[model samples]
Target: MNAAANAPRKLPGPVRAVGRRLPRMPASIAFATALNLTLRRKFPADVLDRLEGHTFAIVVEDAGVELLFRVRARRFVPVAQAAEPVLRFRAVAWDYATLAAREADPDTLFFNRRLLVEGDTEIALLVKNTLDTIDIPRTRGILRRVLRAAAPGGG
Candidate 1:
């Protein structure tokens, strides 16, 4: 392959600017809101109820976003900024998008070290297993489109 083929494509200036601002935005709030609605609808009340009071952090390494969350009143909410997390998951943006889109399996990503889990191992495994079992076609489709749009050279 030529150098051009091997080179990383850059996003357009405007898209790059938007990407830069995304991390600074209320990422935790947005994430919590989205998950609160979707997870609640997809999973049973009893299932989510078991995770009550558990705090988890999602660290998007490439995007430089860290969001902490917890379960309260059977609703998932973003933890306060100062809250210490019990379980933390770390992955690059693209990897996470594909994982959410169902293009990548959790075990595959974990085996490859593309995704990482820190803190409470039991809770981490529980989340991974829960995510693996759920099938949200609509949400996955939306995530696929959003990721494609944000990808370098996609536009």
Candidate 2:
């Protein structure tokens, strides 16, 4: 393993600023599309039914971005806003990446206050457990490559 890969990487301030200024709909759309493409088939029908009609928000603190979406027709749909979301996850972008990469455990992050979850605890656990059950092909490698490319002196 390369030393660069092991080093911590943070999004540049300018990049974060750009992320903050960017529109949410496009981001939400991309997020939903990726979710549908990668994890939709793995999700149980019962879980989908339970998730239906519930809004969710992911707040990226450092990026200053909030993605609002809901499960409708068994698909994730981006929404501009929601009065109240059934679940809200707040975390920095790197933390989210690490979580997705499985380099950092969600429980550790939550306990350390790096990842914050709000709203329905049961649903949150369901989501977490469901994610843990399925394996996404090349997730860690892909995320590592992406992070490496994004890092200042990396790649």
Candidate 3:
């Protein structure tokens, strides 16, 4: 394989700038909706209950976006910045994509400092362990699998 082909891709600066300016509500809504459709059923009800009223933030550094959400009524909902989040995850967009694609392990990323998880250690462990237990079905194409994993409601 060519070295260029193996190189990591980064989101363009202009695109990142646009991403930074994206309205938090809409982005959060989309993210929450995707999570609801894909991982909601996979998460145990008790876990959801435990997460209730707790806010979380995902900061995509390269994308220049911070998504804030809370679990309400056993569902994830977008929330405006009010108080400190119970947990905050920070990483570049490529790292996040690799995670979603299952091309990179979260534990490895965390240990390597490529992925940062802060605040409420117990809650962070709960979320991480919960996610580790999930098993998304494997599909033929990586992109297809990612898309299906993101929006499993279609299938």
Writing each residue's lDDT as its tens digit, candidate 1 over 42-138 gives: 7667767778888888877655567777888888787655356778888766677777787666776676676788787777777778887888988
Deviation of model 1 at 150, angstroms: 4.6
Relative to the true structure, candidate 2 reaches a TM of 0.86
Q: Indicate the worst ten consecutive residues by lDDT in candidate 2.
A: 1-10
Top candidate when judged by TM-score against the true structure:
2
lDDT (0-100) at residue 113 of candidate 1?
Answer: 76
- Runs off by more than 4 Å, candidate 2: 1-9, 148-154
**lDDT score, candidate 3, position 48:** 97
Winning model by lDDT = 2
lDDT of 2 by residue, 39-150 (tens): 8888998999999999999998878789888999889888887999999999888878877776677887787777899999999999999988888858768987876676
Please rank every candidate by lDDT, starting with the best.
Answer: 2, 3, 1
Give the Cα lDDT of each candidate: 0.71, 0.83, 0.77
Question: 15 in model 3: Cα distance from truth in Å?
Answer: 1.6
Residue 81 C-alpha lDDT in model 2: 79
Worst 10 residues of 3 by lDDT: 1-10
Where model 3 places Cα greater than 4 Å from the true spot, the runs are 1-9, 138-155
Instruction: Give the Cα error of residue 10 in candidate 2, in Å.
Output: 3.8
